[model samples]
Target: MRRSRLSTRGLTEGAIQAALVAVLALLTRYVPLAVLATTFLMPLPLMVLTIRHGVRPAVLAAVVSGVVAGMLSGDLLTGVGILVAVAPFGIMVGWGTRRGWSGPAIVGMAVLVSGASLVVNGLLLLAFLGINPVQQYGEMVLTMRQQMDTAASLYGRLGLGQEAAESYRRTMLAVLDLMPRLVLFGFVATAVTTGWLNYEIARPILRRVGHPLPALPPASTWRVPGFALWLLPLAWLISALGWQPVTTLSDRLRSSLPPAPLPVPSDLGLNLLALLSVALLVQGVIVGWVFLGRYRLHRALRVLLLLWLTFNPIFSNLLLIVGLVDSIFPLRERLGRRAAPAEVKP
Candidate 1:
């Protein structure tokens, strides 16, 4: 009898949370503050339910939310979008936290799940709708280029020459060409970042509500595995050695085949480099945080340092290098040992 009552209460709570998620998902489509709502707010209720009730309730809430959202929007695709975009991420995060996974581990799992979900959704769309999304996006990019070309006269009046306008258009076209190839990596990065942000936001709320949450290690103590240091160099070597040969091979194949295959080596190398850079960037941020804490830096100064590191490309790259070196050298541990003697003297 007691188990039955507990189960009933769980269902009621799940339903309420599901309704909240549906409302937020609807708001994201039409709201003026769509970025803020979608990034931070919309995922909260579902995350809370997951934290409180575990995986089954969370999955149920996600399905119910999708259904409710579909009804409100009058488009079944909207429901699928919600399920694909939001649900798996929340579920992975909740499950990881419940199992006492570390911050990095949780984020890593969420990124993998998010990437897989994107691929699956893309496949589904291709199978049912006869639509190639990458091709569609590329076409949209071309359409934009045409529109910009039409506006070239306006640019000329604004003192920009035709040559400069044409150069800008080419740059944009190059970026668009790369976008489809990098979609999976980009999705993974987005998932990791947004999942981390949501976790930081939800942690305190979960604590307030008496839910158990895993403790994240301090930034000063964080360390990437040593094997990660080899990735960037390896990627560079592959690109340098294989790019020309692969391009020639791909061209020959393209001439022979009706449909051209993707340039695998180039795409893989670029994506691997990007992924390694992000990992190093994170390590760099953590190293900065550790230094700030060790020196007892003023709050304003710390904020300025962070802003500079984030905005200045040179500084960002320098930090990435520092992070890469530290991974192999244990720089923080050495620094700690040097600092240790001063405390003994005091």
Candidate 2:
């Protein structure tokens, strides 16, 4: 009898959540302005359901919601695509909330999910488009190079000279050389951001609705794992290897079995460097936020500083150094000891 009631309750909650997810999906799909909103709202129902019930029920609910959404939208592709993109992050976050996990742990899981989904996206692109992104990028570059050559010939005839055209092309290629890694890191960083945003949004709403998650630790105390300091050297080492030696080493290490149908990123070093940079960058941002409160900087100054940190050309390397230093030594704790009594810690 007790088992029956448990099953019934799970079903009831799952049905309600599944309906909500479907409604959000349809609403976000049809309402053009609500397009950006799918990211926040679509996963929310599943997340809340997972928190209240468990992962199993949440998975079931996701499938049902996807089906209902597909039917309502008259297209299964949109439903499935959005579900794959957003559901894992939500479900993992929900599980973390249920288990009393920290903010970073939850976000880490979201990163993994988001990264794996990139592989799925690549596969889909290959299946439908007959070429993956890396291949498409190479083709695009080649086409652009040909166009530049033709343009340079015209420039030379016009007395403008080919030097300017060649230089422009070189500059563009150099900036786009590390695109694969940039794309991957972009997804990773976005997953982290969305994971954090969901938790921040969910915490107060859940508490008021009587499904409060464990409270987040103070942001001033936000510290990456001690071992994360190694990422700097590891990234640098991989980047130093570049593509040839790295690919050779990988080939030697890999088994003699046939390669998978999917494409592998040739610029392995750049990918690792980019991925590691994202981790370091997050730590640096937190360090900045913590210090902002530690010194009681003026609100206007804080805003300007944040803008500079985000937009400055030197921000990447600067933040990378700060993150690595903070990871190796307790810079926050050390500096925090001297903070004034009136200053509020983040």
Candidate 3:
């Protein structure tokens, strides 16, 4: 009799959570806060359900949410979008937390889910909806070019010489041209960032709800594995060696100094370079945090330092380099050891 009552209560709770998830999913389709809700808030209800009720209940809630969203939006595509864009992320994060995974490991899982969802959704759209994302991206680039051309006078009014303005336009166009080719990498990066942000937001809420949550290591103590540094050199070598023949051909064609052929780095090389840079940047930020705590830096100084590193490309690169060297050398560990006796002495 007691077991039956417990089972009944569990089902009731799951239904309530499912309804909440459905409501939030429906809200994501409306105006005003649509983009913000879809991007950041839509996953929270599912995440809350998963944390409170376990995987089975959470999965059921997600399916219910999708169906309700589809019915409300008057299209099955809404359900498909929820399944593709939101369900996997919430499920993975919740499962990872329940399984006691570290913050980085959970984040890695989220990235994989996000990237796979992007590919799957793209294929679905092309196969069923007759929409080619690549063609749409190309159209977007053309539109941007047209807008930039119309704004040439504004550039001139900003004191840019014709040559400088033209160079700026060319640079912007080049980035747009590259966007379609780098879509996969961009998706993965976005997923990784979003996963981290969501995890940070969810951690405190989960704790408050009586879920077992692991504490992340302090930023000063954080250390990425050292082998990531090897990718930097490998990426540079591949970039230099992969396109020699193309470079030679382009040089021959450009004897009259017309626009040179744009050199395209191998996708693998670009991915490796980008991933390594991000890892090192994270390590650098942790090292900075350690310094601030060890030396008791003022709050305002710390904020100013962060803003400077964020806005200044040169300083950012320097931080990345510092992070790379620290990965191999364990600079923070050494410094902490040296400071220990002084700290202990009164």
Count of steric clashes across candidates, in order: 0, 0, 0
lDDT of each: 0.74, 0.71, 0.72
Q: Write the per-residue lDDT of candidate 1 for residues 214-265, one digit (tens) a residue.
A: 6567766777788876777877765554433234457668567543233345
Which 10 successive residues of model 3 have the least lDDT summed?
A: 256-265
The C-alpha TM-scores of every prediction are 0.74, 0.71, 0.78
**Whole-model lDDT, candidate 3?**
0.72
Query: What is the Å distance of residue 21 in model 1 from its true position?
Result: 1.8
* Model 3: per-residue Cα lDDT over 1-346, one tens digit each: 9977766665677677667666766776676567674556666666766665567777777788789888988978778888787888887887887677887788778778877887888888998799987788778877887888757758988888888888877877776766655655676687777767766766786777776456666667777787767778888666554533234456557565543233555665666677777778878877776666677788788878877895576888978887888999977766554243544555
Candidate 1, clashing residue pairs? Answer: none
lDDT of 1: 0.74
User: For candidate 2, what is the TM-score?
Assistant: 0.71
Query: Candidate 1 — number of clashing residue pairs?
Result: 0
Q: What are the RMSD figures for all models against the true structure?
A: 5.3, 7.4, 5.5
- Top lDDT hit: 1
lDDT of 2 by residue, 113-155 (tens): 7777667767776775677776776677667756766776777
